[model samples]
Target: MNLAMRRSPWATLTVLALAQFIVVLDVTIVNVALPHIQSGLGFTTDGLQWVISAYILLFGGFLLLGGRVADLLGSRRVFITGLALFGVSSLAGGLATSPVQLIAARAVQGFGGALLSPAALGILTITFEHGRRRNIAMGVWGGLAGLGGTAGVVLGGVLVDSLSWRWVFIVNVPIVIALVIATPVFVRPIAPHQGNRSFDLLGAVLGTGGLLAVVYGVVRAEPVGWSSAEVIGFLATGVVMLAAFLAVEARTTAPLVPLRLLRARALSTAGGALALNGAAFLSMFFLTAIFLQQVRGDSALRTGVEFLPMGGAAILGAVMATPLVTRLGTRPVMMVGAVLNVAGLLLLARVDAHGSYPTGLMPGLIIFGAGLSAIAVPAQIAAVVDVSHQEAGAASGVVQAFQQVGGALGLAIVSTLSTSRTTSAIASGASQSDGLTDGFHRGLLVAAVYAVVTIAVTFLSPRLAPSPEQIAEAAAVAA
Candidate 1:
């Protein structure tokens, strides 16, 4: 069979985009169905957090290994395996009979996704020949990442509101099926990269373990209090394990992160900005939902609808920024985005406890969406800048893993910040609503900080990026 050397035609883009959508949509979809999921599964109070966290911790932690696997194995084969696992895991989660069953299934789902995301990106790299078609495919791919945020809100609400919470997982069934049927025909199988290189087993273990420990510590601190021995011990353990992973990487022959790849100013700045961007994106959606429903008395459906502005704006902003990146380069477009995000988040913080949705919430979401779109796309381009085809999967995987891990950290940190402020506000004898809004405001402040740091990082990004000539040359090197 001939390799799929050209970009995916319309039919291919549609299938691949849908595939990307299914994978990412899973990440945010469950959040909206938390209440329904809890009631259905008879979960313990803390079980809901686990439902989300288990998947995130596993998915984020394994992405680097997963990415490299796509490179070493054929991208097409890995993609198929990942998709099959995802479909099966979702089926299991949907049919879950007990709390343990659900939690375990969720972990399985996370593992499947860990494999799926990187493989999907790698497939795009292979299928989409460099140029306008590649840009559009990536835009669609990037847009779907934004779409996941949108689908999470609308689909979760509709699923829970209309049918059962299980449908959230079940909906993916058809989508996955479509992709499986489509990929073999549309995506030609590439040769397996049987380089002399060996797998980094130590790096995998250390990296995965270190991230899990950090996430565990962050989550534990919320319920156990900051001073609790469990929280402190977990936190300490995370730091030590992460440090050990770094040491191992430095000494290893074929390390997970080749030191040379870090030399590009574009990659470093984009990576740093990505961490902060993750903090801002994850924290805002969740924290705002809490403020809307808990403090301001909005229905679940209403709250979901309210976030449409952010989702829509993000898509629009991303579309608008693409042309600019082609003309102006990556750093400028992303820097502009970082500026908008910082301003918008700060504006969100100023929204009063008694503020109405149309006046306060709508504007905030719009600004944020615009800001998010601008930063996200160019940042993605920067992360994979000038990477050899052999390293395409690894490079993309690193960015994806950082994004997931950073998001996990943000949820924890924001939860803590909100709790502390809410406690202080309550102690000061403020009204219940006021105290709750105060907590949200404090969380937004932290989000604002994330945006600000991202801006500074964007400025640190090199103005120049690899030209179209250079990117096309990359594939030639691998050949």
Candidate 2:
């Protein structure tokens, strides 16, 4: 049979995008359902965070290794394997009766996503000839990924309000089933690359374990005082393990992360900025969900509906980003994005117990969404500035991983900040709603600060000339 089995490229792209869509969609789908999940599972406020944190940690931590595995074991095989794992885990999550069960399932789902995401991207890169067609496919892919993220909130709301919060996870089971069946029909099978196919098991374990420990420490600090021995021990353990991970990577033949990539000024700067951006965006969304439902007394459905405009604004920003970057360059676009994010977060910080959504959250939500997408596109481009073909995947993976890991870490810290302030306010004799609002304000203020720092980081991004080839390649790599 001919390579690709002579399958239509669009068909392959569709399959790949759908796979990616599920990966992105899972990130936010659970946010709207969080309240329902907590009530149903009787989760402690501090314990509830693990539902989201577990997924992001495993997904981000395993992502680079997943890509490397796909390269050695074939994209088609890994994609199917990931889909199966996701489907099984989603079913388990839906049926979970305890918080631990649900959290464990989410972690597995994250690992599956780690395996699925890169395989899909790898397939897309190989399927399309590297030029206009590939660029267009990647654009469609990028746009769809954003939509999937925004759509998750809406979809989760509908499912939670109408069916049950369990459906938020159950919904994925059918989708994964369909994707698995469709995979062979559309996605071309590539033979596993023949060579030294060593896996980085130690690095993956140490790195992921270290992050989990640190995030655990942060989460625990909210419930138990930060001075507690448990918190301090976890923090110390995480730091030492991370330090050890670096040492191992420096010596390993097949490292999970190539330390030399940090030497690329553009990659390092953009990666840092992307990490901060991820932190702000993820924490903002998590707090907004709680604010709308718990503080403002909105139904799950209403909260999701309220987020519609923000989602639309985000899509608009993504669509507009390419043209803006093409005309103005990455640095200017990034600066504007950073400013808009700060403005949005500041507006959101004004949310009060007495305020209405229209008067308080709507405008901020819209602007924040737009700013989030705007920064995202340019950062992706800047991260790849002057990168060679050989290092492109590694560089892209590094930044993307930073974004996910940053999001998980950010969520943990911000949740603690918000909870701490809320406790203080409530203890000070404020009304429950007022105390919650105060907490939300603090969290959003911190997100605004992160965005403000992002503005400064944009200056460090190297300028990539708007040449057609460079744009096309960078954009595709970004997707």
Candidate 3:
């Protein structure tokens, strides 16, 4: 037996989950600190965006490459390497003196996250045997990840208020250090697949480049307008590059992403459904955050605290989903979750211009948050249902990439629509609060539509996943 086989599996899982938590946390922790970062770094109003955009661009762009690399190399090696890079970059970002320096650090941090997140998932899937145990593991993984985003805002608020904005980045250092030290002790060494290990240089370049351009364009659309020349140019280029990448993948003998993976019905279906779930879920958070601060007149700290109930609901839903999935299967549970998401969005859409949080927000936030978790846990499980142990990293990367792209694209579209509605309302005779409320309603409605679409896509998933015996047989054949 290897070193890992001797260690406790749950301990191994705890290490992986903590690493992924920090990765997810960084995605939103910076949001609460943006204003402080601007003043500290002397960033221009427009240039301040690069602090966040730099991270999103790199993290979203390099996920596929990171996953494939983990598969080509070894999961434990790649996971540890990612932790070191992420920790070092976080330290650099915390100590930066200039906007340029900070932005550069954030970019590197994002790249590290790209490498770490999927590899962590790959290790988890490999460590746990698929079935009830894996389902429970995924539930914990999915729940913590969902909670991390919500926690980021809350923790960022406390750090920025109590200490300085730099603490947001600095806080990750100790946790990462602990994880790096523990990983090798608890995690097993999964050897790389033995064969021709020729890397797909062309596919990696085109795929990463294409995703970067697309994410950059999507993020830029809100500030610059989708019609802006810069937005149009980047988006057009991204489409062309992505098309070329697909063509290259189809022809390459050793493709970065083997095209055959798409033929796995469960993987494809779950990826699509999760993309839409990401769209609605992220947009809901964005819209609700603004509504609380701008319309409800809550402080940033208070706003973060207010979201706690919803975050708790998400955890509960995640815990509830594991047993339900083991009994009912993935498709039915996914459909129910998607429908609940739509119901929640509609409730949020009806928020009054002047109303209490309990009456106007709690109901919707609780339902939406729970629904989001329900979808996430199952979709994560399904994404790897038919995938072999060797490709777990790549499969995890694909699922993460889909969600990242969806969140970016959905946020852009929903925010644009909301802003236009608010502008129009203000142009007429509406009060500022009323106009903001109208805009939020419009955005929430759009998010509701996205959830509805997710319900439709969930239907494509098989009613039942392969039995544990069948999964083992398949893995053996593939190996």
Candidate 4:
């Protein structure tokens, strides 16, 4: 073991968690700055969404491959490489003078994120033994993961308002420099997976292509009619490619995702629940940002400040989850979270054009933020706890992939619905503000429905009962 690993494992966790935070932060930091970016680069409205989509598509599509690579190579090597790439890409993005340049840089940043996230997670799983210690670490990890995107909104506003939108990307340079300097001193290397299993090149190609096509189709379905030949062709191609990917996985000796991993009821169900949670959670952010700025006429800075409470609430929920999971187990705690999520979304559906933040928005944001933290922490723990060390990266990657894909698909669906409703209301002579508010409420209602389904799924899914050995470990930790 390295001197750092021998002296303090907590140091290693901190470094890993910080890296994860930066990766997740980039996902939403650019959202609030989109208008600025578009105006600066003279981008068409349709082309602007690609600034976000490019990152998500590549991040989601390559995660499994990235995870397996982390396992085949050492985690430390992959993590550092990813950090360097991310730093370079962020610099490129900050210097970008054109729409294409910025979008390309963002896509590369996403690729680096895919490499960093799973490897950091795999290192965490191996560094901390399973039980209370691991649970606590996961709670912290989950809290940071949950906070990153929401906090990004607030940070983006501050940066854009005080400085320029370019500062949002430039700010990462200093942080990345700090992390790189500290990494060798604080984090230790882990052994790679043994045996000579070749990387699944064919599986990676099929899976990446299929996911890209599907996400593209979903994103474009709103601008172009769903019945458009482009939408149908992309969707059909995606499905066929995914089926082929699965076939390849079944036959390959070392698949990108092991088929046996899907048989674990706890992991599989948690992944599904996480996907649904992602759909609702991300939609909440997207719609609320629009409602605050467009309907309520709040400035970007004010919108960011308004979101501060949600971030605090999420951190608190993560802190509380550790003991709750210890006392009640993962399934029950997750079900409670689902109930809170449904209630919060239902309340949010009451937002109107002439509403105030406290009565109309704060209540739902607080409740939903708490619920999101609860679900995210436990779902993350359950997804990897049952898996072997060698498969940890793949498991983490799968859970995160579901989240990215869910967010993309959910945003597309809700945005399409909101646009259609707003257009219809305007056609009927409603004012623009009221029409937009109406559409936002309708979208919130759909999000509430998704939360309700999440509750049902949590109830019906098999419980993640700890094994006897795990129970003993927990008891010892308590003592």
Candidate 5:
């Protein structure tokens, strides 16, 4: 490739970052708009969860498959297609007048997201050279991840309050259209590698169906009764299908997720931790947002502002953890993160109705942010450590797949548990809505317990760090 023929690095970053930012930003944006969406669309409690779940389900389900498509079909083509689909879907969602339409559009957006996100990462790693520049780029990438979650809440709150929630989806149309125009000119294309890599259709069906079943079962555990036949049947079906997927992957020549990747102790363990940690982490954002809005009756912007301190603390913690990860090794750093996360979750149980924002929420938010900062960097590092530079996109895609799936699962489960307990408490003849607060507290406590379990699992992980040789090799390959 001629140097002059290539696009500016800044242009590349702009498109890639915008792609990631939009994908991540929507997660929080929806959180902010949930009440509005529910009211506007006549959504039931179950439908509200679908608002988030629909996107994640497709995003996670199609992610590995999407990565494969980029590899086989060419990243730029796939990316442009993704961009077009996403823009159209957003328009559909923005214009949606009924619950079914909005849910369907969100699902389409997830499919587009699955295509765009991995291709964006592939473009970034390939476009930029390696070494310190790569680290800085990855930092930017990670920072955006950090900011996306935090920014979403803050910005989403402001957007929804000042503008209609429809503006949320409508806003993306212009940005994506602009980015799409720039992509072909600026975004580098992969030379088409000739091969007949088959799509694992059976694997996809089994894997996706299994995951959906497990998610449904977990979500319905509290609401439908843990012992109910429906929950058990779904859980069993999900497990069986997933197991079948694993078996098929091992036997197939081309697999969506190569079982070989799971051989690396650090990468596998880190991926699992990332997923579990996401489950715990998303719970806080969802629960706290509802608390501020529904229980405390705070305005959206106020809710956003109240959380500013947590974002800063989270940044501080993440920066602090990066250096510590170098010195202490990835597994140990993660163990510490898991511990902090549990501590935060435990403390969050103390929040009450009409509670002080700083006094009630700050402690948990700060600690949680610190925990994310510590673990997320190391986990990301571990995931890509052995990935061939050319395959960085695939690695990034897998990590994201785990995250979206974790978010969907966590949101479903936590919502179910809290809502079930709250509804039961209310129906059991509680004097007031204040009685529902108990369910939120209990949910937090359970989440804390889950955090502790994650920490304990961290002990089983390898206490390995990147050797100097591996670092040098990685740098050379990335270059």
Candidate 6:
């Protein structure tokens, strides 16, 4: 670590958090620019979904491997390599003139993100003491996760409207460059595990293949019905691959994911809640974005601006979570978040063709955003709370992978249901606006159901506090 980082760990954290912000920001920034990209590249509606799906596929699929690699190698090394690759991929994506080229670049970008995200989180875990300081850092990290998506929508809109859609991708180049230069100076290096240096090649292959197949199957289910042969084939293949992976992990001397980790109540329960949270919250963004632009006839810029309140609410909630968790504990805070999310989604379900923003959307967005911060912050903290330093990356990866898979699966289910509703309404002679509104409302109701389930699950989770070893280690490092 450089003098600056040694002097103030917060500076190091800022660099790491900014790196995370860029990766998370990329996830949604492309949403607002999809229309421009579709027109420019002459993409069909079916093909357009690939733009997002491609990134999600690689990111989710390779996350475990990336995290494992970080633990086996060094967090600093993986982080720098990932940052450079992401920057180059972003530049390539920005300059692409064909859908194929853009999609390929996006896949590469996802791989880079898979590498960067876990390593960054691991660094944060090892850097801060597992107490108030770490809690505050986690809150900031979680807030940025919420902030990134909200900011992405707004930034994508501004860039698309004021300049070109390409600017959305291009914007990453400078940020990546700055991060690359600063990372080595600010971040301390983590040593690899001495016990097992062997790579889990088969596990990596099976896990990645399985996740990719599953996400692909989910995305495909929308265009082709769930019962379609193509969807069935992909889902089957994914299941087999994943089953094989589990078998491999159970036998391997140096497994990519230690089976023992999943046995922990706090980690397991946090994973479940994170998955449900991702399903409801991520899909809400997608559904709401479409409703704002397609159904309500709002411009991209206006849609982006309107989401600012949600962003602010999310940040506020995340900031508040640290103190609340300190006072109340993780499970209670998570339950409260789930209840708030359900209320928000229920309110949003009342939206109609003629509904105004204040009554129909604003209240729900604000409440849901706050709930999002509440759940996400604590869940993430719980995932790595008592984990050994060597396993930090892997634990973080598990939580994130569940989140990605859940988001993909939830979006598919919701999209299929909503589209079916819209198609049925249109067939019955309802106007386009009314049909769309009806479909969106139904989707929101399903999301509310997801929130309800999350609340129920919170009761089963064990209440976990920072372990003594964790606090001692953190204190030693600080001293």
Better of 2 and 6 by TM-score: 2
Error of 3 at 330 (Å): 2.7
lDDT per residue for candidate 2 within 367-469, as digits (tens), equals 9989988888888887885788888888999999999998899889988888899899999999888888888899889888889889888877776546656
The CA-based lDDT of model 1 is what?
A: 0.75
Cα distance off (Å), candidate 2, residue 92: 1.0
lDDT accuracy of residue 305 in candidate 4: 85
Compose the digit string of candidate 4's lDDT tens values, residues 1-479.
Answer: 66855437688878887888888898778777766787789975446666776787678877877777888898888988888888999999999999999989988988888888778877887788877788778657755766786679889889988999898899888888888888777878788989765879799789878977787787677678889999999999999999999999999998877878878877788778888888887777777776777778776677788888887787788678757776777788888888889888888888776777899789988999899878876776677777775576567667777777776667666766776787789889999898888888888888887788778867866666565455333322221
- Using TM-score as the measure, the top candidate is 2
State TM-scores per candidate.
0.85, 0.96, 0.82, 0.87, 0.91, 0.86
> Clashes in model 3: which pairs?
none
Stretches > 4 Å off in candidate 4: 1-14, 42-49, 97-99, 123-147, 181-194, 384-393, 465-479
Q: In candidate 2, list every pair of residues with a backbone clash.
A: none
lDDT over C-alpha atoms for residue 352 of model 3: 83
lDDT of each: 0.75, 0.88, 0.79, 0.78, 0.76, 0.80
Question: lDDT per residue, candidate 1, 1-479, as tens digits?
Answer: 34444324655666666776877788778777765676778974333456766677678777777777777887778888888888988989899988888778877777777776777776776676877677667666766666776878887777867888898889888888878887888877778777745768788788778777777677666567879999889888888888988888788877777656666776667667777787788888767866776677665677678888888888789668767777898888888888888888888898876777788878888998899878877777777756666665456566666777787777667767787777778889987788878888988999988898887888888875556654333222211
Error of 5 at 122 (Å): 1.6
Models ranked on lDDT: 2, 6, 3, 4, 5, 1
TM-score, structure 3 vs. true: 0.82
Task: Give the poorly placed runs of model 6, Cα more than 4 Å off.
Answer: 1-14, 42-50, 122-146, 181-194, 386-393, 463-479
Error of 6 at 335 (Å): 2.0
RMSD in Å for candidate 5, one decimal? 3.0
State candidate 2's TM-score.
Answer: 0.96
User: Going through the candidates in order, what is the number of backbone clashes in each?
Assistant: 0, 0, 0, 0, 0, 0
Off by over 4 Å in 2: 1-6
In the order shown, the candidates' Cα RMSDs to the true structure are 4.1, 1.9, 4.5, 3.8, 3.0, 3.8
| TM-score: the better of candidates 3 and 4 | 4
The alpha-carbon deviation from the true structure for residue 134 of candidate 5, after best TM-score superposition, in angstroms, is 3.9
TM-score rank, highest first? 2, 5, 4, 6, 1, 3
